[model samples]
Target: MKLNKILVYVIMILVLITSCKKDIVAGEVQDTEKKIECEEVEETPKEIVIDIDDIYNSVDIDIGYVELENLNEDNVPEIDLEYYPKDGDFILKKVSDGYICVSLEEYEDENALEDYLSPMVYRFNENGKLSWKKHYDYKTHVGKIGQVLTFDDDSFIFHIDSYQDWNEGRLINDNCYLIKCNKDGEEEWTKEYSNSNRDMLANILLSDSEEILIIGEWKAKDGKEYDDIDKGLKEELNNDIVITKLDAEGNMIEQKSFGGSNDEHVDIVGYDKKLGIIIEAISFSNDGPFAVDIIDKWNNDFIACIDEKNLEIKWIYRLVGGKYTTNNRFSINNGMVYMIVTQNNRNRQHSQSLITIDDKGNASKLITQTYDQMVDKFNSLMILQNGDIVIGEGNQYISSLRIFDDTGKVKKVIHDINLVPDEIIPTDDGGFIVKSRRQIKTVPQPIYVSCIWYDTELVMMKYDSNYNIEWRKTYDRYKNNPYWDCVIPLNNGKQITEIKTDYRKSCID
Candidate 1:
């Protein structure tokens, strides 16, 4: 009996031991599975998300509660105020001493059969004192100034277009002339060029090798009268872009023409050491040799690089398809071309694109970016020394600046209500200077209606390296300054701006 009881006890103990071993194995297996799951989670990559709203919110800083003025108290030097014979276009340029203001004048009578246009040149000293004022009286010749280029040697040149009827054969055509002058406003030499029956100068530039490049539109005489523009003759005329190269002595060296059956117009001209003379132009013909590579059959703008040595086209790239708005800007840095193209799409949607082209004319990169609001146009483009690009955009309600990196990412944005940037100039202290126009509403007086007249004020704003506004100034003429022509930076960290003062009040309907 005792042996049987002991065997039963041993059997019970064996069963208990087996149960304990199974429980241990189950727990080990559960822990191993959990370790594997954790490893899998760690191996998976996390998606990166960039919040554009955060970026915008971070950089959109308030300028201030009040608009500050940093302009020098000396004010724009006032010169001898002369009565304008007639309303005509004028251009103001910065000189070593002060400023040069040139305007075209004509007789007050518009219906006169025989009249002449005069080129008026005025030089103002640094104190707004008139140094010399003169006008070229071209008898029986209609004259207009295209551009005035100033040199460091106290000399200047003016690109003039003169229209006259030849006394020999009664032939009527326009002539382009380069009039060089000394600092004393004395004419040095006058060089004349006749490309076609009608020649209109667009832009002029001085190359690194001291060659002068003149680009303009040239049209052959098609048995039309000189003043036939009243007959809507522009549609029937074939306008070709002509580029003429001249030496320092005002002697023509070479001339090149580019166009098709349709009309072509030049918008901008720039020069680069590697790309030579770069031209941005618009083409309306798709079947012509120059327009063959155009993307569409209608309006298109393109960039062409011409070889400086051979005076031949190096490469051309067309901006695929869209109606490019005005104020298109471009800059060349480190032998690369950076352009800002604002286009109005067919669907009425406006978009701005940043294009980069290499020396081989290869448009390697295109970054199409749009703002939240409907973008009107990009007015200016500036390439910094650090390969960063700064673009200015202005619409009816807002004006802002966008800074982009080399990869075309928006790194920063600046907003200012009172600033509508016309030009963005970078300063030497790693900051920026923005030149813009500000519109102010004058208080109503007994003589004029309330809120009907608006005055244009030229504004200049300086920013620090951190993109903070250092100072803002408005060159307040206070009278009837309706137009802000241009602004130039002076060496002493000051700015000189030109305001076209018309005493006649302009009414805004």
Candidate 2:
């Protein structure tokens, strides 16, 4: 912009001198005013039109990567040992005066896969070119990083839970860590939090005052594979909210565990000064009818609760999932809670619940809808800037981004993506960026990223916000993608995007 102004001034001076026909413009004040007006218009910076195809022309995913379970290869639904099928990363945030994206990348090394947390962050120039890259311990247990968060312009934070190797530590060796990485993709510091039994990193809210509030699971279980799947994947039994508060420099200020031994999940948020209370929407298996069995958690749903400020029960709200409920979804915004639960009668279906729990934890069910194609079975809550909600339908195929007012009425359905929207970001302008992918048919059966955008008009019929033809970019990763994927809008009129690539391949299971 400064350069634009300078060039404009120079052009104006040149025009004035040329127009000053010494003989005719000596007294022409009108000409001087016209020149000034022209100069002002020239001083304004023009919105530079950019094209996507010119930027990220194409990508080549390294061969022999293994993350995807390989749903299709040699015509079989189940996967063999060779398919590196992993999901793309989700979550995008503003970085510095620009944007920093935290997507996933895969690298295979038999010795390296043990560390659990390996694939790291890659920095991009303002023009969206890959600048440098960083990685975590590509050694022990192959740390599964989650919830990559940007704390500020020059740095970011993410979670890492190292698994128990064949060597040392307890059965489920774990410690939740809050790491700080520099601009050049360097780990500056890290704060570790753990308990005697089982502690798994879940989510975090980096505060406005540079203080970070970390939320996760503090579960206790044995070493059996069934026990491992129950706690790690199914999120069954051993429930406790693991809360760790730390400053910007990675110093743990306060740490505690809250919740019962059944269900405790934390979706965190914070600014910079204080670590806010945990608004945990809990589901107890103890309630409901007697038709429930320990081996099958398919019949569990109860009152959701919030655990915060030590083990204090801030509030509790009842959520009825009927007799044939599979799972339920809930979220908190502006001290309010919204939930969605699935009901199975003849076939499976879902309903979105908009509820508000007061300070005492008493919940008021406001709106409930069994409307669309399929609500996201995993999660269906997105709060807009104006307090409106954009909810999804089902996990396999999120039919629409249904809008709801504060009163919880189905207002409208913005851009509809047939598959699950892995990520949706509200842009500064009255628009949004949606990033998702679908399974494709190929030898390795690649997954293609499907990107779309919707303007303020709230219509899915139209989707061109640029002067170019193709408004979205797609990528195909055949194997080994065990990380996040996102589209970053940078300040320099470019999109900073990352895809899963570069796998080193492991020798054993």
For TM-score, the strongest prediction is 1
Each candidate structure's TM-score, on Cα atoms with residue i matched to residue i, is: 0.66, 0.54
Give the least accurate 10-residue stretch of model 2, judged by summed lDDT: 453-462
Please write out the lDDT profile of model 2 over residues 118-216, one tens digit for every residue.
445655444444555555653334345566777555778866555554556446555645567876667788766452322445566655466666655
> CA lDDT, every prediction?
0.65, 0.45
Q: Candidate 1, residues 287-345: lDDT per residue as tens digits?
A: 55367555453447788888876678888887765645346568898889998766655
C-alpha root-mean-square deviation, each candidate: 27.1, 22.1
